[model samples]
Target: MQARVTGHVQGVGFRYATAQRARELGIVGYARNRDDGSVEVGMAGHDDDVANLIDWLQTGPSAARVDQVTSEEIAPQSWTDFQTG
Candidate 1:
């Protein structure tokens, strides 16, 4: 799944937390901050894991006040591990 998390996602450890969560779930992907102050997360894994990650993106870390989480199904991409940027 490809997701764009909005609101107070940036500057709040969202990306790093996401990477940690993904790794724990054995997911492969990447999370990065956009210029518009949103966090972009791209992940590939089991259907349930993807859904769980999307749900987590809505709340983010304790410091993040997530306003929105928009996501869509996309073609799967291969990755060795999850990362944050």
Candidate 2:
């Protein structure tokens, strides 16, 4: 799944926190800061895990003021581990 998380997502450790959460859920992918002040996440794993991650992305870390999270299914991609960039 790919998600574009909006609103106060930058500079709040959102990417790093996402990486941590993904690791906890055993999801594999990456999270990065977008130029548009959103955070983009690409996560792949069991269907349940992906869904869990998307749910988490809506609220993010304690400091994050997440306004929206838009996610969609995409063609499967391979990732050995979750990362932040």
lDDT of 2 by residue, 1-85 (tens): 8999999999999999999999999999999999999999999998999999999998999999999999888888879999899
Which lDDT values do the candidates have, in the order given?
Answer: 0.91, 0.94
**Cα deviation in Å at residue 82, candidate 1?**
0.2
TM-scores, each model vs. reference: 0.95, 0.97
TM-score of 2: 0.97
lDDT of 1 by residue, 1-85 (tens): 8999999988888999999999888889999999999999999988899888888888989999999999988887878899887
Worst 10 residues of 2 by lDDT: 70-79
Model 1 / residue 6 / CA error / Å: 0.3
Clashes of each: 0, 0
Which stretches of model 1 miss by more than 4 angstroms?
none
